[model samples]
Target: MTLLGDAAHPMVPRFGQGAGQAIEDGFALAVLLEHAKRDKIPARLKAYQELRLERTSRV
Candidate 1:
């Protein structure tokens, strides 16, 4: 399953990009998920983590 919107990234909620970025992440995750089934959960999650980490680290 993929999490999206504010449900995924609960940021300051003032940047206005939280929802937008979450949607972007959802789409990206969907593309990643389509490439692999549940077997790719680890990798998919890793990708999400990488993205979130990168974004958060930038903050």
Candidate 2:
């Protein structure tokens, strides 16, 4: 399973990025999954992680 939002990148409540990041993560993952082949789900999930890790870490 994959984590998103606060579960993925918990931050100080003052920063207020938890919901937005989660939404963004969900949207991005959804997009990736939508275009991925049935047998490529794992690859797509990895791609999702790679795609979000850098950005999330920065936040």
- Model number with the top TM-score: 2
User: Can you list the residue pairs that collide in candidate 1?
Assistant: none
Worst 10 residues of 1 by lDDT: 50-59
Off by over 4 Å in 1: 1-4
lDDT of 2 by residue, 1-59 (tens): 78888988897787678988988999999999996778999999899999999999998
Q: Residues 1-59, candidate 1, lDDT per residue (tens digit)? A: 54665676667758687766776777777776776877878888788767766664454
- How close to the true structure is residue 20 of candidate 1, measured as C-alpha lDDT? 69
TM-score of each: 0.61, 0.87
